[model samples]
Target: MRSAPLLLLLALTPPLLRAPEGNQTRIGPAWSDSRNPIVTTFSGKRLDLWSLRPLTKAPPKRSIDAFLGTTNARTTDKRSLARRLSFDLTGLPPTQSDLASFTTAAAYGDKLLGRRSYGEHQARLWLDVVRYSDSNGFDWDEFRPLAWRFRDYVVRSFNADKPYDRFITEQLAGDELVAGKPKTAADQDALLATSYLRLGPWDNSAGLFGEANRVRNALMNDLVETTGTAFLGLTMACARCHDHKTEPLAQKDFYRFRAFFEGVTFRDDLSLALASDQEPLKGLLVTDGDKPPATTHVLAGGDLNQPKEEVSFGFPTVLDPNPVALCKPVREKSTGRRLTLARWIVAKENPLTARVLVNRIWQQHFGEGLVATPGDFGYAGARPKNQALLDFLARYFRDSGWSVKKLHRLIVSSRAYQSTQSPRRLSAEQLRDAVLQTSGQLTERHGGPPIWPPLPDEVLKANPAFLDDNKEKTKSWYPSPPERLGVRSLYLVQKRTVAIPLMATFDLPDNAVSCSRRTTSTVAPQALTLLNNPFLTDASLVFAKRVEKSPEADKVAVAFVLALQRVPRLDERRLCEDLLKKHGIPALCRALFNLNEFVYLD
Candidate 1:
């Protein structure tokens, strides 16, 4: 039997060994050698890829404006600047009093950056990059109830002004940090931070042969891809199947990088003792399973079943040629691979991490980054139009104790950031929160579990998978109590299969992949949602009630200032008054909500 199979293999091999034709060389079998051909010598052009090169040092006192040569750029008026700063820092529109009392841009920027709302807003942006959701994604889409602990942790981290490098360490290796015994509330918070590993979509359903391995590989792949795009701004998933087509990343590099996470497994039974209240709450986190890690191999064509030559733990060879030494903890249940990886990521010698972070912050404030592609720093992505400015920002970020608030202050104080620019639409969360704040309906509670706001009957009916059917009486989707409906949009439950209708209309990103920059689309549904959605209608009614006691002329002025952050002109006030008399204050409120000035930031 062995001889017969060997003869068959020999007969099949000859076809691949055929004589060379023309200038083409003969090719070998598909799996002849599992190892990819390594190219150690990169050309000068390849070495000069902007993001991959070492960071260029700058003088200690150089300002952001000096690098951009934008010192002559004109600043916007105080009211517009106040509104912009409020939305940029806190994701909320300025109050009438806030606009009235606005002083210098720097002072106002510092004030907003210090608020609790700043953390909530920044957490939402960071959550988008990590694909954080409250449920498993695929067909089953089961809920992950304790996931909000991680969300709250992120909010607290930002508000406390935790160093960016420390933030990276906690999310990547928080469980390892408490490997011996957790003694403090900070240690417990570290455990919650490990939930970052479990944020991606998962499939709970069983499948065919080798399905377990397949699901595990899918998860590992998501972790590696998310880590790359979220921290390094590289499209590493492109190298999983073969050598990356456009960049220097290789197939082996992908598997070796993934090997760092081979020991990780989910742990949901852990309890965190809350600092606010001494009660213990169940938490979702990741831990290294109590066993030696399985050896990882380069999968032929990225298939779990076609595993090839085994690879060891290491960073991407393109980023650093040295190998990492893993320290196995004798007293703990971990390989310590993740901690090593995390340290390397935030190390001063690493080129991509700081640059990627500052670029994302710039994108949030300016509607686009200096490098237009926030997540891709590969050969295929856009090169920074202002490399000197980007380098200066990156160096300053790392040197200033990796402080995000300091970075925000530095950037906002620049003429480049404060200058007048074309108007940009509010993000989904900002628009929703602004509507609630304008109507005086926004709940000011900080955090706990996510809340389920009311969804349209059609939307609920469409997503049958969102309901739990295992119980005797099938549990259907139910909105939270009426009081909680007014909470900020960040607290809304983020089900993978069912998006809140209004948010979906305004382009809430699908939570299945890392989203560095959200796509802004102009469509009929956006207008229709604002005009016809019951949430907006109810908000308008509440807003009308707030201003109905005032005189008609005063009502128009108050409404305009509240919604648009500026006083209404004579022509606008006259038109609004006519609408107010004919259709009532609610009608005028509804019309204000639909205005370009109300929903857009200038």
Candidate 2:
């Protein structure tokens, strides 16, 4: 059977293929400004065009199809519309197959949502919210060698349309809740479950207990901070040290937040140490862990060891203390602190949880959330364009019992999500690969361990050569080779000293901290990746070759539809013909592959 990501792809509507509406807030059909919202397409088979909507009522037509109406509809030029969708969803262009399908679909106005390729495109957005990473990034470089196990779990989660709440609970509390002493298949993904304890920027050069505390603290902090912004649209970090100086949080609340992970500790289960955190447990308890809390004190400036005053954690003022206020979780032998906090966070009445999550889903599809900052919802942050709508969404999230995939279906089913104005950011690596697969280029290698993809020279330098010293004969490097191609980004080892330049250039987080939103930079270095990088060049060659060999259309037309997602403009078509004449079809294809507009989502 096809996998979950594949399944989701099959369920989607391509970003480029849409039945237009009138007076549109969705940008693409109109192509309003150069700043028009990015409509994401996950290859042609899967697009998020039918996913998001701001209102339930009948909405406006796509700009391209709206004013053009029946009078000039067929005659009006659609060169720009096609190009936008191809780049946004597929991350590649229309191929001969795509052109024939989209051309017929657009003309006849049929329901274009049922192919396996479509849902895979939508899966791209799911990867980002989880902060999926291959290697452990912090002072410790490669301990998370096989953490791709977690990445695979994520891919499977989205592909299977795992209910969102179940997804969150499993990731956050899996190891603790799963049954068995050593973990079993019947144990509800225990090895897969330990990943819950594995999220965040962790380093342990300090000391085991202290380091465990640190990682635990860091995870808690990340849990609070990212969860807040990612799901609630609130800047909860400001409340950490003292209180949110601006947002509705208070100092006591931050401590109450810290109280959750009061008993978490990390032990590298593997001393064989092939750079993975694989320490065989002498009886390593993955969850419901029994540990001792040394002390609780107010760090004068946030230094854990340094204490100014004896302090106990409490709930934030912005948040009602009722969740855990009455029943204080304690630890004589075990700390129920985290369980208390998580229950509170996911509680049905918790106003911000569902709201923030829904906002993220909306943001994924629309390119902008009702409240723009996403993570930081404070007085100083961008005000919600539609507060009532955000509230409605949040309520829906809670009432739905935090069903993530169902939300996907709901949002995608909306006219807004389906609109051409899909404001896209990167759909994480899995999403990117899934789209590739739908386009018949994706490689779905299931779990074993993480594999490293090619990286720029600088990124390689920063990453420690993952080696086994005792064996002495040979040691395998995690990132493989710097020049390798066709490897997925998820397999690349993360380095604290340096990041994959292409990812960073495209605004990927460094993994040092929790990043809820990435800055979409249009800098020169990013351009260099598209223009000069070997990967892009190779991929372009692959894209070009795919188009050239495919029948059913002229080579130029096929390339434009497949690679660029739209037909070429008269001028652009002329330029291609000129490049072919001046140099050769190969040279012309190379030139077209290097265009700035081709790589970036508009």
**Highest lDDT scorer:** 1
Worst 10 residues of 2 by lDDT: 37-46
lDDT of 1 by residue, 1-602 (tens): 01123234333332312223452343322112112133332221243356766677778878888888789999988888888899999999988777767788889888898889999999999999999999887776777777898999999999999999989988988888885546677887788898999999887774554477778889999999999999999898988998787776778889989999999888776666555656666686788888888899998889888989998988766544345677554327787888888987888867789999999999988999988999999889999978777889999999999999999999899898889977999999999999999999988878987888887777776776645455532124558898889989999999888888899888899999999999999898899999999999999999988877656658888888778877789899889889977998899999999998888888
TM-score per candidate, chains pooled:
0.91, 0.70
Return the lDDT, model 1, position 160.
Answer: 95
Supply candidate 2's per-residue lDDT for 23.
Answer: 26
Q: How far is candidate 2 from the true structure (C-alpha RMSD, Å)?
A: 14.2
Best candidate per TM-score, number? 1
RMSD of each: 9.7, 14.2
What is the Cα-based lDDT of residue 75 in candidate 1? Answer: 95
